[model samples]
Each structure stands twice: as C-alpha cells, then as structure tokens.
Target: MSEGTAISDASASRAASSSAPLAERYAEAMIPVFGTPQRVLVRGEGCRVWDDAGRAYLDLLGGIAVNALGHGHPALVDALAKQAPQLAHVSNFFATEPQIELAETLLSLAGAPQGSGVFFANSGTEANEAAFKLARRHGGAERPRILALENSFHGRTMGALALTSKAAYREPFAPLPGGVEFIPSGDTAALEAALAPRDVAAVVAEPIQGEAGVRPLDPAYLRALREATRDTGTLLILDEVQTGIGRTGSWFAHQGVEGVVPDAMTLAKGLGGGFPIGAMIAFGPEVRGLLTAGQHGTTFGGNPLGAAVALAVLGTIREDGLLEHVRTLGESFAARVLALGDPRITEVRGAGLLRGIGLAEPIAPQVAAAALEAGFIVNAPDPSTIRIAPPLVITDQELGSFADALPALLDAAAPAAAGAAAPVDPSAAPAADDKDPS
Candidate 1:
C-alpha cells in the first residue's frame, strides 16, 4: 500500500473518531461485523424511532421482531423500574419469584405437558447452545448424528452456527462441531430418508425461517418431522427465536397451527421485549432429564429484572388481545397489500406480524434503501424479499401508512426503464403459518 493512502486513511479514521458524526464514530470504534449502521437511532416510542439526525422512521422491522411491545411501553418500563428497585438479580444457587413465575407462565402458554422444564439463557444463541448440548447428551456415543434444515438460521454462536445452514455464516468458522447435516426444507421424503437409520439425535428447525427471507415451513411438513423424529427416538427441537413470544399472534408460531408439538423449543428475541433473555423448553420429564444438574448453568440467565419484564410483556399481550389483533391484522395485511394490484409484489409470506413482502424481481435491497429514505424502516433479508416484523402492538393505521407508501417505495427502487404504473387506491385500515404445534 502507498504511504500517502495509508496516511490519508489514518487521518480519515482520526477525523471520524473525533467529531465527524455518530455513524462515523461507530465505524471508528466498532468492528465491521454488521457492515454499517443504517441510522444512528437515539430514541424511540411506539412504532417509530428517531435517528441522531432527528428524523423519524416507522419501525416496520421492530428491531427484527425483538420489540414486541414497540418502544417505551409502560408495562416494560414499569416492570424494570419496579424490579430494579426490588430484587434485580440473584445467584443461580438461589431462586427468585420473577424467574419461577416467568417459567410457569411460559410453560402454560406453550401447553407443555406435565413434568416439562425451562432453562434460561441470555440470548437465542446461548439457548441454542444449551439445546445443542442436550441433543448431544441425548444421543450419547451411539447416536451421534444431528440434523438441521436447509435455509435455516438457528443463531450465531458456534453451536447454533453449526446448526445454521447458510454457507456464508458457517464457513468462516470452519470445522464447527460436526455430525450436523442439512436436508431440503419442507421435504417430507428427505426427512424420512435421513431418519431411516434412527441414528440422528435431534432435528432443529424454525417454523418460519426469519433470517432466510421469512419463509415458513409447511404445517404438514412439521407434522411429518414430529412423527419421524418420534418414531426414530430423535429429539425434535423447534427454533422459535423469531416466531415465539407473540410475534406470530400466538405464544409460538407453531401454536397457530395444530398437531406439531416439538420435544424441545428455543426462545428469545421478543421474549423480554427488547431485553436480553432466551429460553429452551423441554417438552417432558424425559427430555428435561437430559440435562441433569451441573451439566449446564448460567449466572445471569434468569435474572429477576429480565424475568419481570418478560412477564409484563406476556401479560400485556394477553390483556390487550394483541394475539388476536395480530392474527386478524395479518390476514387483512396480506390482502390489502395484494389488493393494490402492484405487479412488483409477488406475495406476502409468513404468519401473523412476522411477514416478508416477496418481490417480483431482486429489488428488495433497493426497496429497503428507498423505504428508509421515505421515513420507513424495513430490511432485505434476501435480494428478492423485504421483511417487515412490526411490533405486535402496531396498529392498522400505522401499517396502512407503509402500505400506502409502498408503491412509491417500489417505484423509486425499480429500474427506470421498467415503465407503466397502475393506479392504486389504498383505503387506510387494518383487517384480518406453518408447522402445526400445540
């Protein structure tokens, strides 16, 4: 490299760190794992967040489905405010009411059978990491193989990354703990064939593969997984990191369907309504016993503060009937978007508020960029799919605003040469998955 270029780069970094801008300073201080920040958001309320520049954008992504109650909801704030003043945390040697209560509530909501158990962690990957250990323990030396699905995203930790199918995410950390295999998603035959040997330990899947363009697995396919895994004595682990915690209008997305109960399930993301908390539920005593005492532990997994907040989030969802609202709004949400008759949109995929607006062409990145410019926030999970997971508390009017602006967003994103537009009359309003569970 030239000395002049090196010196120039160093100067630029120094300037950015000094006082250039919040985003520039972020680049100077943080690693480039996420590439760049779309905006330097300072604060948020309800379904909107304000950037450092003071511009407000509708938060359609809802922090990628983590902000279940939107922002600054009194339930969450009060829960933390109250809990922090009380017993905020306790060592694992002892227990707390909030933690125990949260576990019971989650079990009841999940319809977990008698003798089920819950293990808490700080994030989804940690939960999956625990699930991975359980799977290995269940398999022991004889049944060492584990199976995951193609286009699946478990999490980012090494164990979870091993279960994740994307080559890009798993390749860099090559030689990840082995015995993990990927099969065609939604393919019943492949699932059966893979389990024929009865040598696999556990099969992990997401009801809706959120990171993989929000594609939802078929309910029938999930049922097949349950039957096959059960027949082979293999554990069925559902990764509901994105679908659980009422994001899909239910305790878990799988509950919206029927006859697809997993032997174990992973949870996080919206569980604490933006607070860091993750959980793995063992469906019955047998599976729960897989992880005996001292086999695994965490210091702050079920801290009272996070537990209290999660309880409040769950309680508010039930009290406010957000699940039914999400369900009704989700159906209408799809129809309304299609009613526009815009040729660019292919279909709305996913269950409840967890949706992906599939495009006719690979213009999702451009559309996401245009969305931000138009005072809206969405993400392109894939080149052809725009993911929108607005807070469960989001209203029809708020979503209608985005729907009303969708055409302009698409227009600005599409190639200029692709001409001729259709008239769209978006009547503002609200109305209205996958692997069967519960």
Candidate 2:
C-alpha cells in the first residue's frame, strides 16, 4: 500500500476504536494536564478549523500565536516535505546548511551587530533557559539576581519559571532557581530602583506581556530600561516568544519601538509558522560567548527539518509582505471592535495582530465559551480579558465577521445588569492552565 493509504488506514483504525466519546477517550489515554480538550479538532485550512463533529470555527488564537502562516500553507508543507526525506535529524556534533542558514536569517532579521550568535532550542522555555544561563555567566557571582516584570511570562522551565511573575504558576513549583526578582511592568522608576545597585545580572521583559492579558509595556519605559540597564551594565533580555515573527508588524515587537535594543532576545512561537523551533539571539561579544562549549545542548533543537521549515516561514513572511499586512489589518480590526462600543468591552489592548479585549466584568470564561459556540475560537487569558492573536493570513472580512458577532457573544455570555456586576465567585472563573494561549 502507498504511504498515504497506510496513514489513512491508521487514522481510521484509531478513530474507530475511540468511538466511546472524545472526553472519555482523552481521559483514558492522556494526563489531566490541560483540564480537557476544548474541541476534537480534526482538520484545518487557512484560518478555519473543523471539529470531529463537523463544526467549523474561525481560529483567532492561531494555536496561541504559533501558526503564523496559518494551517497547512503550501510553502510550509513544501519545505517540510522536501527536507524531511533528505535530511531530518542529525546530532549537534554536525551542522546542516539549513541550520546555519536559519541562524544567519534570524540574526539578520534581528539586526544584531557583528560578533553575535544564536542558541537553538525546541520551545520557548528552553530558549529562555539558555538566556538565563547567559545572564548568570555574564553577571558572575556578585551580581546574581535576574529581574523580570510583575505581569511577565517567560516559560515553564525551572530557570524561566523563576523569572515568571504569576504566583499561581510559581508557588506550586517552589524551591525554584533563586536570584530572580519581579518589578512592575511599566514602572521605569521601579526598574531604575531595582537596577540602581547594579546587582542584577539581567533584566528580562516581554515587549508585550502575553499571559497577563496582553499588556504592552510603554515604549518610553522600554527606552528608559535600555538606558538604565546600559548605565548599570545589566543585560536586557526581551522575551518575544509570542510577539515575534511578524506577529506585531515587525520582525520583533521591540523593533516597533524606536532606538531600543536588547542584549539578548528569545523567540519561538511563530518562528517556524507551526513547527516547533526556538532560539536565543545574543548581541555583542559579551553576551554571545557566555554559553561557550559543553555548557548547554539540545538533541533536536536545530534539526534540519525545523530549520528548513523556519526558513520557509521567514521567506514567506518577507515575500508576502505580511508585516505590512498585519499592521494594516490589525489596526482596522481593533478599530472595528472598539467602535462597537459594547458596554462590556472596556478596552482594546495590544498592537498589530496581537489584541486583547478587556471586559467590564469577570466573565471572560463565559464569553470564551459563548464565542466557541458561536463558531469562533478565542482565548480568555484572564478572568476579564479576551485575547485574539489570529493567523496573520486571516483576512479583513473574516475579522469583520468576528467583530459583528462580538456584541451578541458578550450579551449571551452575560446579560447586562443595570447596577450589579457579574457574579465573581471562584468557580465562575476557571484557573488558567499550563497551556496559556497568550
């Protein structure tokens, strides 16, 4: 039988056996990590996905900002198909052309100066771990503390977890790597005070805080941070895992702001369109060589398959001029949503394709469920925020449909109370899980 036929038969057999029910099958076969599968998504094309029951929904979350080119773009498919059979995995002892090319491409896109380097990893967490090690190496023994913002999120690994500010995520995983401090996100004074002593090895920040309801740090504050860190000799690390790769109308979100560059930047999410790939791009000799040899490694970090896929993703973004497209569409979409003037929608936050709708009450979970039922998929990162990081390929018409549907969705989620607020009980809002769709 052909390879396609064999795969089809395998999928048929698995689906036949799991007729017991989607939830039951998941419960029996998988760990209770993500609570429950939101939907048994079976197929996708462009910005739309289909569930097993044949329901279609507009995918606004874009796999939490990982699907830059959207589901199964021809370029991405061609790249994976051409590269996988030829050279998929080779140990780190040897480097492939695609791997080297990808590294060069990322550095070029980041506009890093000479003597810069990159460390590849499989996820955002690993990339952040590498950055953490670089910070420690640069700081030495005396300046040990690593500083991150109050509403920031790096990743889930031990070192990255230490830098994350959410109590619920960090408290459970206590005794984590020490020497991490949390400062307010947009407070330049607080940052200056924290870095005044020069005891900080690094100051890590997300140009836009994704998990904390898509809060963007003020650009002036970021410039101030650059100045403060420079004066104190502290490294500035930007976590662009969710905001990079043309998602925010630039190669990196920090680039949208003027005259602010980081010592190191962590990128993953959309770097490979949908394939898993992460990288830490360190600028200057001081930050680049800190890792050295044998300090850190990953078996599948920069494999030929991922590298080829990432190169294709980058090429597509550049050739298609998606950066300008995202900026235009994003501004229009945000304006349309805000113009609805729904009482429930308090504010619309974020830039480019990454957006968050802040609600007047804590009914985000209900709003999300209502949206799902209304043939749309969105994320409630917090109890009162709805985040929309749709595929860059999403068209203006598709976004308009969601915008037209927003007011009704909010009404269905919570009927407006003239003087009373929506019920705010513990059970009313579910705790956000590890798979943060930020």
Candidate 3:
C-alpha cells in the first residue's frame, strides 16, 4: 500500500471507532495479551493522560517506566519531529550518525572500558534476546550452563524467556532452551555452589527486578556476584531494563554501588523515553567480540529515529539533573506514604521512582483499581505488591497528589479486597515474600 493510502486507512479506522466504547473495540479488534487494557488513553501531556471519556489521570506508572520525561515533553517531541523527516530508518548494512552517537553516549554512561560496544533493539525483550545470544556465543562448547535468579523477570521472547525464572510466564512455552537454572537470588553460597563446577556460561539478573514487585538486589550482593563471576570466568549480565536511564536516580542502577561493573548490561523501557528502544552493552574487548557480524541482527534495531530520541532522553536527564531530582523526590514520596500510618501499607520497597508498596494483605489488585478510579495510575505486579515507576520528570506535587489520595483509595478497596482477594495459602510460598525491604 502507498504511504498516503495507509495513513488514510488508519484515520478511517479511528473515525469508525470514535463513537464506540474503546474497550469493546479493543477486545474485538486486538488480541488479549494484557487481558484488556484498563483504560483507552486518548492523549497525554507531562505526567497526565486523558481517557476517551475525557477524564484525566495522574500517570504515576509512566507507561511502566518507559516515559522517562513523562508524556509529550518538548525535547522528545522535537527530537522525533526533527529526526523522522531527516532520516528515520536505514538498513543495518549502512550506519547512521544518530546510531553511532547513541552507542558512544551509552558506552560513556556505562563507564565500559576500552573496546566496549553496544547492540540495539526495539524493546526490552529484544534487548534481552540479544544478550542471550551473546551469552551463548561466549559459552560456546566449553560452558553450557546459565544461571538466573528465582522470581526474577527478564523478558518474554523465546531466548529471554529461557533466562526468566517466573514459572507462569515460562511454563506454557517449555521446553525452553536447556542448561538454564534458577538459583536463589542474593544467596552468596548458592551462587558460589552454582559456579563451583566452572561450567556455567553466564549469570543474568536484574539490578532491580521490576516485574518481581520492584525488588532491588543488595549492592553488597551485586559486588559479590561480580567478584565471583570474574573468578569463575562467567559473564555477569545485569538487566537494567526498568531501572536504567535515571529511573533509580542513576544513569544505571548498579552505578549506585561503587566498584561494581557487569560484563554485559541490558537496557530498555525508559531508554528512549517511550520510543521503543533497547540496547545491550558489552564491557571490555573480550565480551564485546562475542557475536561477530552475521551471528545476530535486527531490521529495526539501530534505526536513526530511535537513536535520536534516546540521545534526547539521556541529554535531557543530564541537563535537567533529573537523577538528583528522582532521588530526592523518591525518598520523600516513600516517607510520605509510610507517614500516612495506614495499616494496609506495610512498607515501600525499592529506590527512586521504581517502587513497590508492600501491603499487609493480598489487596494490591483492589488498591490499584481504586487508585485508577481515583484518577491516579498504578499497578499491582503481584498479589501483594503495588508497583509504581512513574516518570523521572514527575514533580513533588504530582506525587504528593497520589499520596494524599492513597488512604481513601485503600479505604475504597477494603470492601472489595475482603470479598475478592484470594486467601493466603499457608502451605504455598508467599507470592511477594514482602520483597525484602532491607
């Protein structure tokens, strides 16, 4: 189809659905991967989004940490507008300036040593998939085993899925690529035992396991992991998909821990400020040389448009000092939630904007629903964990609004939770395990 014809057809589809309930239209026209989106968002402007009914919501979830600058920020908008007309996409056979510049900036931010490199993809799962390939190539015939943390989330693609430890997301797809094992996260002895055989190719983990209820691994544990992996010749790959690009008040979440650097790092979510970009950075010469040329590639991986937008996001974060702002506001916001003295709220777990509000009972779903009804956006990653990873540019007032309404939201949810929440299974393990606040 011609470009103009395709545009017209899309516009016609929008017009046909103008009067219909978007939820019904969505159900009819789309697959239910996400089990029916809660709201049909029409548009957004800096920390707020509007539904089809014209109701506005404070977007505390920030598109699940993809909208680093919130919505429709001028810098991001300008970058997209400028880049699209100039040069949007090019085949991987030819390189673009934006792609080169973006890769360079990422390498610098990561503090990767000389001979480091980056491979770009279009989403979090794709980035993890690339990292998976890198791991396999490095392992080759000598080391075939891979280690991932229990309850950790990486991504959903086949290769990435193999590394993810969530049973629900993995069970249906098996038998996945073998030689991947789940070990207890943060248990030094378990990790040591896993590596003692010297057959494990790599260990993949998230600095903050966002989908596992925004849980942040201990810095000391991370340091030990790095040391042990180095000693054993295993690659330490940190999945920073949700916590990178100032989400956790740092360029990368692990940067908060001194003298700790992974052999490979995967990034996505907020990297392009919602522009659908992902990257895998290989540190040092040996790791960088893993996948030579034809071993792996993607058609849309390093498109100029995505690279330009990501550069804009990084530049904006640095220029506006959103890192420090995120740190200060996140601390204050967590404190405010705790100070509310609501019994339903157990404690806030995580750092910076990436946080999970621990609950006394399995009422997180009801609470998230209540928050949505009360014009705030949040989510329940698990039965007892309310995960909130708002935009880095979100202000004190924006967050304060949610905190002020949280008590009432909880009150609204109490009745529903009492009737609808699943009873805690005494024999089964807790879904969240309180997410280890310490």
Candidate 4:
C-alpha cells in the first residue's frame, strides 16, 4: 500500500478499536451496582468534566458533594504527589507527621476540647462505624438502644445502615445491628420521649438531611436535642459526612446551631477533597476515651497520602476564603432560582453550597435528565427534589449560567397534570448495590 493509504488505514483501525460502546464494556466487566453508567467521563478540570465522547459538562453536583476544591485542583494534586513517594502507607502502629497534623487541624477546626480524640477511617461509612462503636462503648451494657431521626442518612455500612432511617435501604439488609429507634425529625417532643427512658446510647442526627432531599434540622430543635442528650447522658453524634468540610458554608453544619456541640461528629466527603478519607472526632472527656486502642483500627485509614491531601484541602478552604464565597453564592443561587417563578418550583432549601430545588410535582428525575442534556450535572435525590451541590471553588460566572438556565430546565420537566403520576423510569428501581446519599 502507498504511504497515504497506510496512514488512512491506521486511523481507521484506531477509530474502530475506540468505537466499542463504553456502557456495554462497563456491563461486561463491572457489576450493575449504579445501574447503567450515565456517561463515560474521561477528564475533568475546575468545575467541568468531559466524557469519553468529548462532551463537556458543568459539574454542579460535585461528585455528590465530595469534590470540595473541584476536579484536579493544584493544591490537592501537589500535596498527593509530594507525599506519595515519601511515605504513602503506614500502619497505625507507626505515626506519620501528616496524620498527626491533620488530626490536630481537624480538632482545632471543630473547636473540640483539650481531651478530644480522633479516629481515622477510609470512607464516610467507616467514620460513622467508628462513631457507632464509640457510642456503644460510652453507653456500656445497660444503655443498649440508639436513637436516630426520621428521614436521616448516616452511611451504607451495616453499622451505619442500622442508624439510617430509610426502611427501603435498611430492610433489604434485614436484621441489622439491633436496638435502634427512629423518631420524627425536628420533633423535639418525640426526641425527648425517646431519651426519657434513659436507655439510649446515642442520639445521631444530620444537621441537614442530605439524602432526604436536603431537609435541615431546625436550629432550635438541635439545641433542644443537645439539652435532652446532655440531661440523659447520651452521646450526640452528628453525621457531618455530607455537610462537613465547608459544604454548608461552615467548617461543620452543627456550628450553625448555636450552643450545640455534639459528643462525636463523623467527617468525610469533602475531607481529602475527593481522595477518600473519613474521621470520627469525639469531644469532651466523657466520650473521648470510649474507643480504646485495641477496640478499633484500619489498615489504610490515616495513610500519609490521604492525610496530606486532607491538609491541603483544609488549608486551601481557609486561605482562599471559599467559606464566605460559598455562603454568598449559595444564597444568591437559591434566591435567583426561586425568583424565576416557574410555577413548577415549590421551594428552595438548604444552606451554603448544598441546595435542593423542590418541584410542584414529582419531576426531579426528568429535570435532572434535561439538565444533563443541557450540559449541566445535577442530582435527583428524590422524586420531587433536585439537589445542587456545586464545588466551593465554582465561580460566579458558572453560577450565573446555571441560574439563567434554571427556568428552561424546569419548564422542560413540567409534569403532565395536577395529580398525574411521575413518568416511570426503567432504571429507577433499586440496583444490586444500595444507592449512596446524594
């Protein structure tokens, strides 16, 4: 063949090889846990991601609130690159500088007392698992029961799953760790009644119920909970996995509720800025020593790489003043979307960067689909709610673009009639693996 013919043939061969459908490949090689892959994302920068097909999309969900600094941030990348070769993985028996510094940093950020302690884990579920064990130890044998709020989500691990109130998520894993009770969220009376028995080990709550469509616990109710738990001597564990790390315009969501300090708080998601790290921070002397040395542990929980990345994330959030930026931008975004008056929108909820757009009808899935088609990524956490958790580093220009497109997106997703059922989506059913909190 001639040189030109050879070049053309090579190009065609490469194209043919690359043409295999990614979804088909995924189905063949991986379990159908998350249903079909929405899109084969290949690259990301700032607040944008590109699919294997080379389509660019503005990432508004931020990897379900895990991407605090946005994709491929220089600080996180630099920290990880620098630490990886130095001392990436170290056993708990050995101490690493990054781990100690990150722990101290987290405690200071949390305003924990002098006697506070921290336990590192690999994910949000593990963090909650550690906190669960702490509560168990603190409560001792006599106090066996635990109390969690209705419509709350902690994590998906068996121990954390027991604390989660969604029946659908918990029932399948049936006969979970026992002695857990679910009370109506934000009902101080119900909380009081549940703790009145004094048999409760801990009262676990999420300052904002992210999985239940971004419902925030009333500040007053949270304060009441603090008092109730204090009176009953029950540990109060706040699952800040989805709301911590400045996702809610603060170091932690519970801080918004004045005078309410949790006995223990689980941190993850934004921590490590997408590198997968989790921590259980215990405050006050009472609960600090509950988890003894041999009581709990992990292989790669506080590895140097993850610790360095977390330090970089926390440092950037402080130095860059992203917390205030998130506060201002979040309020503006919510107000602008609500002002569109699309009639289809009922309300806007949540604080800081974590937002939920409530629709008049059950059209969130359709709205999310429409948004995706429009080059935006969002989450339909429930049938009636669209969760928007863009990265804290997102610029005003990006927020403005999304705000301008909100009305059109909602219009495209409008329901057929007043009481008509939501359009059925074949893939909406539960997958082999449980769904993660949005």
* CA lDDT of every candidate: 0.89, 0.89, 0.89, 0.87
- Candidate 2: residue 335 lDDT (0-100): 91
Error (Å) of candidate 1 at residue 40 is 0.2
Off by over 4 Å in 1: 1-19, 416-438
Error of 3 at 383 (Å): 1.2
Those runs of model 4 whose alpha carbons end farther than 4 Å from true positions after fitting are: 1-19, 415-438
TM-score of 2: 0.91
Error of 3 at 324 (Å): 0.6
Lowest summed lDDT across 10 adjacent residues in model 1 is found at 429-438
When 3 and 4 are scored with TM-score, the better candidate is 3
Which predicted model would earn the best TM-score?
Answer: 3
Worst 10 residues of 2 by lDDT: 427-436
| Model 3 TM | 0.92
Question: Whole-model lDDT, candidate 1?
Answer: 0.89
Listed per model in order, the count of residue pairs whose N, CA or C atoms clash below 3 Å is 1, 0, 0, 0
Model 4 Cα lDDT, one tens digit per residue, 266-324: 99999988998999999977688787778899999989999999999999999999999
